[model samples]
Target: MLRNGQILFLCALALLTLGVLMVTSAGMQIDQASAEQPILVDGGLSPIAIMSGRTGMYAALAIGVMGAMAFVPQRLVERAIKPRPGRFYLMLGVGAAALLGLLLLVYLPGIAREKNFSSRWIEIPAPVFGTLSIQPSEIVKWSMLGLLAWCAVSAGDRLRLFWRGLVPMLIVLGLVCAVIMKEDLGTAVLIGAVGVIVLLAAGAKVWHIGVLAPAATPKPVVDRLNAAINKLLALPDVKTKLDRIGVVPMPETPAEFNKRIQE
Candidate 1:
């Protein structure tokens, strides 16, 4: 019988294979303006050429990475990551600071790049790869998780104390979320949700979790929200449901939504 890890590995491999096939067939469709640029491919420049080549390379690299991580012994992995005797807080502070600094680079001109109107990747030039970009938000997601785990482990017996254990961890988590929220609000929310799960697993008080309620959406963000009636009216499939409800949809800010819910 295939082990659980082996089954997961096979599933991942199948998904990656499907991705490679899609890239190979669909190819990227860049605009004529960008196509004129020479950065895409070294000798030959075309949509299919660039995507097929890069995607193939990335798939190979990903498979190798997965293999390496899967084979590492659990005990050695724990020892490498586990906090040292005296430097738990120091390690968390330094590591989070370094990651935050890296994440901030996504805003720098020439170094930062955008995709789908989101500025969240840093560009790097490599001899073999030509041009490569790294998503600092992806790193921030996992690093925040690691920081939460470290906080939980370090807190240990003092986890019940409000000031001694919980407050400090909450501050760090908030800081990480705030930084990530600048470029990727969706991802920051996901990180916060996962952090809550980690905290609860670590035996944090339920009331303490309740204290971290979701904040109201910003005014600028509220202004950007489309009217609910417009959206509902546009959906042909739900028109009957809306008619039967006999309720009118109106534009409302997030604060208004909260107020109505409370009422």
Candidate 2:
């Protein structure tokens, strides 16, 4: 029997694979800059011009990490809820802090890479990738759940308290969202939603989570789009028409929807 977590991983991997294949199959074209220069075509694959190589490399890296995590022991994962002796700067104790530091580096002039008016990536030159761009927010997003879990478990019964238990986690969530929002509002909203949900499941008070609720964070255009699509798919006629065309209706969470958009 597949566990819920396993099912979720499978779904995510399926989406990633679909994106990789779609990108790899994109038709290649001649180098437009060199189009005026002499060109030779020897029946080689010319249509893979886009970001096929780079996309595949990153996709493979993601899949590899996921595969590794799958085999990790559950006890080890649970043990990670608490930090190790004397070394309090690891995943459990300071994971969020470490990620926060890395994220702040995005504002450090020369190293920061900007695109579309956002400074969310740090560019590092690498062998095959030419210039490898690392988004610290992506790392933080993946680690936040475990960090929140640690926070909740650490808080224990204190979680029932208003200021003591949840506020610290809320601060972490706020800092991350605020930093990411300066560049990527969509992701900031997504992280906020996930953080609140995780804390709620961990026994946080409804009103406690609601403390940060007033924020629409300027706007999360992707989540809004996803919600609208779901409302449309809820209608019987829309569902029937899609079925006739062999279009299966799959509602994605904000995270997954954001990924599809990024791809």
Every candidate's lDDT: 0.70, 0.69
Those runs of model 2 whose alpha carbons end farther than 4 Å from true positions after fitting are: 1-15, 25-52, 62-78, 81-93, 212-263
Candidate 2, residue 75: the lDDT equals: 96
lDDT of 1 by residue, 147-191 (tens): 778868876866666667777777777788788877766566567
Q: Which ten residues in a row have the lowest lDDT in candidate 2?
A: 42-51
Candidate 2, residue 159: Cα displacement in angstroms equals 1.0
How many clashes (backbone N, Cα, C below 3 Å) per candidate?
Answer: 0, 4
lDDT of 2 by residue, 1-263 (tens): 99998899999989997887676555334444475673434233333532257777788789889989989999998785553433322433366678689889888888898887888889888887789889888988877777877767666667778666667678778887788878876666566767777888889866454322233643476557667757856667656645554545566666664465446
CA RMSD, predictions in order: 9.6, 12.0
Error of 2 at 204 (Å): 0.8
lDDT of 1 at 243: 40
